[model samples]
Target: MEEMSTILSDLDEIKSALKKSVTKSDLTDIVKSIVKEMLEENKKEMETRVKEIEDVYMRKCGDLQDKIDGLGLEMESLRELNAKKDTAIRNLNATLDDAMRIANEARSRSNYNEQYSRKNNIKIFGLKESNGENVSSEVCKMLKSPAKVELKEEEILAAHRLPSKFTNAPRPVILKVKNTDIKSRVMKQRAQVKSAGIRISHDVTLLNTRLVQRLSNHENVSQVWYYNGSVFAKLVDSDARIKFDITDDVDLKIRKKLRHPST
Candidate 1:
């Protein structure tokens, strides 16, 4: 009877344990909890990966921005240097212009001085050279034969034939008259002497020759000639003398109406 009672008590305890331990609702709840834990772990892992990506991209973006800033600084430096170079080039150009202006002024003064030195000289061609001949006597005799040169031999300061390397071309005679009146007289009789093939001209500078030729091409310039190594111009109907200056471009039309009575 005692053994039967003990066995019956253990069976009852076993039944109670089974009834409390394994309900279907509790089983479902446990599975749900396990799944929720796994999902939370997966979400944490994904967030870590996302943070890593963000960090990598942020570093790259920072590098790119730094490069852009460095390039901006370099560009600014280059612009400043280019501006300085432009200023330097402009200064050099201005200095060169000043140098050229100074050079031109010096050349003009030199040419003017040369022209001034030869003011009292005259050149005559077609007079043949003779050995040991008195040039003044020859000139006076030649002047009297066809047309009288109003100047006396005593009034001649000096007369000589120009030295030449070429023999075929006749050497011209250069004469310096003593008095201004005699020199004027000789020059005024140039037309009379020219009829006999005598060429009388002022000992003009090379510049004057070119200048006279340039002015003679103009329609308003009737007579273009040199006197006293300087170039002179005459209007078509006027006798007023115009000094042809190469430095200043004076229009001939303005001087055309300025007619001085014939001297």
Candidate 2:
């Protein structure tokens, strides 16, 4: 543009200089030639400018294509990396699940052992107590009378009142018998004793108590009772009497019964 402006200014000066001696026809021809040359130069300059812009645009397009190709490769690599991580995570979760199952099994075994130790025991509540009361004699006498379960005093392995849970009432008596038969007999005759303001239940371990609580929460279960070491349940919806072994996973067993009621 600057060169074209300079050429136009020089032509104007020459026109002024030649105007005094030049005829009209010669001046018109001279000015026409100069205008034609100026137009040719301007067209070449425009073409050159267009070619330069084309070159710059093509280089930028090639650079952008290279960047896009690099991005595609990076994305593919990231996808492969994520796939490997997903497999590793799945394997880790499986291992964790196996470890948890083994741990739970071991804990269940421990709880079973604890509960087994208290299998041949019965707990008697609503019994009066004094400081020097012979717990074994008192328990045997009560069983022989209202409980109607003939139990020898010698069959009583151990006897004691539990630690006082409340000051307003007497503590329940815990009686460990020599065999499970005695405890079963006591539970069998519990209804007769219950009528005389006496409550008889199995001497349960802490683990057994939790199991009983879970069983109690079952919708179909009307009453859950334990005798000796075994668990017995009566369903409200059906006469389907369910029995479970004295295992630590009694809650699991009870829940299984609820899920498959026919079983």
Candidate 3:
């Protein structure tokens, strides 16, 4: 009987131990399932966060691209405006050049016409003057004696004393003849009156007078004179005659003629 009791006790002990082992295994399986569930939840949250970051990055890149496109368009517009301004400036310069050319042509024509009107007039220097004197009669008598040219008072269109800058000297005389032929005859006899301290010249424009004075002062010019309303210059030691006008740059012309005689 004792042996039967001992065997029953051992069996009970074995059954209790098997029940504890089974409980321990069930607890381990439950812990593993809970850990797996937590891992899956964390993975899902991380995926959501990654997706949000990608969306924000794409939006920022799109905004940057739009700004770059806008700047490119603005730059192109500025380039077009600059091109138009450059063209406008060039056109304005061309118009100004044309205006200057037209003005120069008009001035030249006016000077030519003024010189032509005084064709039959003569200027006499070193003529005696009085407070109240008959200038026409004196001119006629002087021409007859010294110049040896006969002139009637009726042939003289006008004779008068011109204003002189020299206060102490006698004023010059301006004589206008009826015809160019009579003027030519008097001019031919001008050398004969040089002994009487008298001088005669054509009535030239003020511009021609200044030009003649300048040419007379030039070192290369030997003689300067006016004939038939035109100015002429003789080069020193050279028989070449140079004809100048009011529009001529005498210095430049002389330099060019000296450099190239053929010109």
Candidate 4:
């Protein structure tokens, strides 16, 4: 009975030690469960923060794209406006060119009419003028003596002394003949009359007069004269005669002639 009691006491001691170990293992499992729950909660919070940041970034990108699209539209509108302005400028230039052409045509026609009206007139220079003298009788006497041409009083349609720029010099005379044929005959004897210190020329337009003077002053030209209301130029060392009108480009024509004499 004593031995049996001692064995039972030993078994009781082993039971107490096993119970202590079970209690410690249960505490370790509880700690591990708590740590896992904490980690899950933290992970959820971080994911939420990341999602919010992504939403904000997407909104900013959309706004920037909208602004870029708006700028593109504005730039396209500006390009169209510029194109329209350029077209309008071209149209205005064309209209201005047409107006200038019409103006030039009208001016040319008016000049032609003015030149045609003075066709049958002649001017006499270096003729003596007296205040009360019969101008027609004096003209007849002068033409008969120096020019060797007889003219009836009726052949001269009109005669008058032009205003003199020099007070002491003789005034020039402008005369209208009955016909162009009679005027031609009188012109034929102008060289003979010029030998007696007289000068005769056609009453040409002012533009033609300037052209004649310009041609006379040119080094390339030998003589400039008028015949049948047209101005002509004789080139130096050339028999080629150039007939010029008021509308001609005289300098360009002369240059062309000098470069290509055959033309």
Candidate number of the best TM-score: 2
Sorted on lDDT, best first, the list reads: 3, 4, 2, 1
Q: Which digits, one per residue and each the tens of the lDDT, describe model 4 over residues 119-163? A: 667899988877798878888888899988997779999988988
Model 3: how far is 205 from its true place, Å?
A: 0.5
- Candidate 3 residue-pair clash tally: 0
RMSD of 2: 9.4
Scored against the true structure, residue 80 in model 3 reaches a CA lDDT of 92
| TM-score to native of every candidate shown | 0.62, 0.72, 0.66, 0.66
Query: Against the true structure, whose lDDT is highest?
Result: 3
Among all windows of 10 consecutive residues in model 1, the one with the lowest summed lDDT is 254-263
The residue pairs in collision within model 2 are: none
In model 1, the number of clashes is 0
State the lDDT at 220 in candidate 2.
Answer: 57
lDDT of candidate model 4 versus the reference: 0.85
- Candidate 1 lDDT tens digits, 1-263: 89999999999999999998989999899999999999999999999999999999999999999999999999999999999999999999999999877876776677788777666677889876678888888888878877776568878888998887778877889988875577677788888889888888877767667777778887777888765646778777776777766554646433444542432
Off by over 4 Å in 3: 1-89
Global lDDT scores for all candidate models: 0.79, 0.82, 0.88, 0.85
On TM-score, the stronger of 1 and 3 is 3
Off by over 4 Å in 2: 1-40, 227-234, 242-263
Q: What is the model-wide C-alpha lDDT for candidate 3? A: 0.88
> Residue 237 deviation, candidate 3, in Å?
4.9
Q: For candidate 2, lDDT tens digit of each residue in 1-263?
A: 99999999999999988886688988799999999999999999999999999999999999999999999999999999999999999999999999888887776678667778988878888988888999998887887788677888899889998988699998999889988776777788989999888898877777667667777897757898765455678877767777654344555765777689887
Lowest summed-lDDT stretch of 10 residues in model 4? Answer: 103-112
